[model samples]
Target chain A: MTAEEWEDFRKGHPKAASLKTVPLPFPELCATLFDGNAATGNPSQCLKLQHSAVIRIQTSRTLEEPKEDNMAKFSIATVFIASISLLLTLTHSFSLENPTDRRILVLVDDLALKSSHSIFFSSLQARGFELDFKLSDDPKIALQRYGQHLYDGLILFSPSTERFGGSLDVAAILDFVDSGKDLIVAADANASDLIRNIAAECGIDFDEDPSAVVIDHGSYAVSETEGDHTLIAADDFIQSDVLLGSTKIEAPVLFKGIGHSLNPANSLVLKVLSGSPSAYSANPKSKLSSPPSLSGSSISLVSVVQARNNARIVFSGSLDLFSNKFFKSTVQKAGSSHKFAKSGNQQFATEISKWVFHERGHLKAVNVRHHRVGETDEPAIYRINDDLEYLVEIYEWSGSNWEPYVANDVQVQFYMMSPYVLKTMSNNKKGLYLASFKVPDVYGVFQFKVEYQRLGYTSLSLAKQIPVRPFRHNEYERFIPTAFPYYGASFSTMAGFLIFSFVYLYSK
Target chain B: MGRSPTTKDDAQALFQSLRSAYAATPTNLKIIDLYVVFAVSTAVIQVVYMAIVGSFPFNSFLSGVLSCVGTAVLAVCLRIQVNKENKEFKDLPPERAFADFVLCNLVLHLVIMNFLG
Candidate 1:
């Protein structure tokens, strides 16, 4: 009997089995002991015991005996399950290439959003993220459970949901980002205070007017009949391929929503797209009363913020920015004859999604080393005026792999209170940067700093503390040419005293 | 005319007494004074030489003049101790003072030799 047959027999009985002997042909006895007569009392217990012994014997020899097909099948099944579990663990570990974010908790107004924004949802899904979608009113919506973070990213697409029904609120949302989670917020014309509060935490202010929509008179998309020019066709996007997409946006993006202003105090927030000079935020159906609070080019159509904690947030006024309709719409400026078959919304949304998800703008610095030009080991301390070389390699993550980050302005500042020596590092195309400089004459605690912040690239701020010491007395040169006159005078006086004393004494 | 003759006679008498007192000075003391004059003159000559040719080797010039001055000073002490008319150094022997002066002169020259050039 095989181990499986014995286990089946053991489960069939209620009491524990004992180790005993059975008499029959090896296969017959093994099969009979497990599935023998349903004997009651001591006899059944004895039979159960015999079955357990036989099962143990069979399993002990299962690996050695290839003839047992059942045992082989059971072992194969265990191996398959173990391997599958190991593969799952490895997949989860490699999911978040950048530690800034990994798992995302996507809260929506309903489960229907999972399919409505399938294009955006699937893009994140393909990137090895575990997205848990819950209705905004679900009592179980939690950013953390038992002090451990439940998610690393959040998407606020439920613009109209009054209040998150669980422990989640405006404060909780801010805490999630403060702990370093990437966020993408798409606000409509009537976005709730919950969303506006969240946007404020990210240093952006949406128009306070509840009914105002982004209205552009000059750049409205030309439709069949002349209608309200509330629908804008904007293409004056930021000219950064890294921030937007590598491909130029040919078609104008159709936007129908409110406008926002980035906080003047927050330097990290940037306006990616601006409204035209004629555009203003006001009630489209009502008569003009007071001056609109947000108007003209001051209205930022799209804004992005990189928090001090390195958390990324993207705020766009229109929730339809990611909708299939805007992605597929054709656009023709009101006064222009050119008509593009598609809008820039799809490409803009996709590329911006990739950036918010950390598929780009990820930087890693490694192999920081400094030594004498040809030496391998770093010295404990640098000598003043010594010629030394410093090398640091930098690479940027491009969704799949690390590629060399090439730039001419990457500099190394040998700093104390101020930069004593600032040198631009030279790099090979492969990302290996090298810089050589003589240590400054001043000696004290100094730092080698690389403060690299460029548009569209994640800022790389690296500072390594090092001590530079003055040369030891013995280390100084024994003879100096400029000071020879001083030395000569010191010795010549001694010689003159000897000659004058001899002459004076002899004359006396 | 009588007043003019009397004034001339008084001046001549004073000169006569001064000459008689100078003739009483000891030969060794006169020799020491001559040596001091010679040392002073040599220092002055060196100073004039420095003024004409610049103090390029100023330390050498200092030690040269100082050595001459030290020798003359030691010689004057010896002359003062040996003088028969002097009472302050009556207990000090002329031979002992001379030996002391020679030893001090040797030490001074050794220091001067080390200091000069």
Candidate 2:
């Protein structure tokens, strides 16, 4: 249309006419281009300019492209693929929902341990771990930044680094685990005070003598080159499939380092691997002195602490537990003839890592509902003496799927000052548990409570408070059988009054 | 029996004069007084019965006692208005007083009956 005709159209429909407009020829060309039909007419000067505009854009984008029959693009494509694959591998190393010491930050006093302990480092890498080896004195070994965590797990391999460099210290490590992370701490003959302090906070006390190494003469892994027999073989692990996995350990765990005593006051910590009755912690190289402070079964070879916040920490007296030499070494316990092909380090580390990473011991409760019998909707308030049925569905996270949490000890309480009715709930095997009961006759305020604490599982404490009210004045029973005598007396008195009035009027 | 004849004669004469004065009252007022006495006696009997039986139905006991007491009060009001010797109530007619007494009794009995149960 002509410009004057378009202006006239705009005047007639002002609301629609306010939108932007393009020239007729340009719109016609766009319609043709969108339809994929090239204009057939002689090439106009404007069409040529549009063609050059499209060509200029394409040429500029491909200007840096190598002219090797698309081999350059193939290389770039491979680079993109490799970058994505690397990212996937890195993320798979450390995890939140499942625990693993995959992407570990190995702090060391000297860089020599990287090569000297290459067996340990290589074993870790072979097991799909990305070990970021940093000298303990590195100025950039920060565990967190601005209250945001940087790692899902931490490993302190530096036993003698007196004080960590940068912002990392005892408090930073503790704060990491406090926020529900995993940790593996290994201390040797001369562990730093900072490491000891961290261990003490988790209810473990390393050997007081800075030079003491756990010397087990009676239970050491029998070797041809045995000197002090301090290299012990421990087979007595804590018997728990949930904690250590269902597979039994066939070989004994080899330990050779300082022993620690778990603090009696800390109940959350447990000794997974305990010292044999004959074992004692005293520097074997030094001459005998007074009785050792830590001896006998009180000394824990390897202990684990599952904090109240579900942070899993494994504290080992020996860094050799992670070494490939120990994992692959043949072991024969002292005074025993049965020889094993390999030690228990590999299986023990892998199973414990799965547990610490939240692949186990994670629970979630949902679908909590309560109502009177035969009712679907939960009421805001319940009347005293109401027959109520409370239902709660509890499921545990089985790494990938939710499974029914089953236990006979799960109980429900109808609580007012204390529980008036404590009943063991019955489950339907599908995780839906129901506790049916009559509301107490006494009314004020009441609560439904469930406190489930199992041996190895995380404790579940849940309570829902709901008020119970007495019946209203009109709502009371209109005629109760028990109250019939009282009613009879009232009516008889009125009848007697009527009769007495008649008798008095006539007799007088 | 052993007193002097003159002292005995004086006591007898005093009681005889009091009896004659009471006998001079109107028959309608005397009837009202008899009704009041009946109501009061009924109230006393009920109270004694409640004490022996135990007040398990306390509401019934209250209604029974109040009914008797209310009747006696209404009868007393009737007697006062109808008595010719009472000059202050001379404007009040005996029929009007009886009608008021009957109306008040109706109201009191209604409340007592409701409270009885």
Deviation from native of the Cα of residue B43 in model 1, angstroms: 17
Writing each residue's lDDT as its tens digit, candidate 1 over A102-169 gives 67878887688777778777777777777788888989888888886678788888888889988999
Task: State how far residue A360 of model 2 sits from its true place (Å).
Answer: 1.3
lDDT of 1: 0.78
The digit string of per-residue lDDT tens for model 1 on B1-117 reads 879999999999999998798678765566666666666666666667668777665656666677767766776777778787789989988768767876887787777655555
Candidate RMSDs in order? 12.9, 11.7
Clashing pairs in 2: A98-A357, A99-A357
- The candidate that wins on lDDT is 1
Once superposed on the true structure, which residue ranges of model 2 sit more than 4 Å away at CA? A1-133, A497-508, B1-117
Please give the C-alpha DockQ score of model 2.
0.09
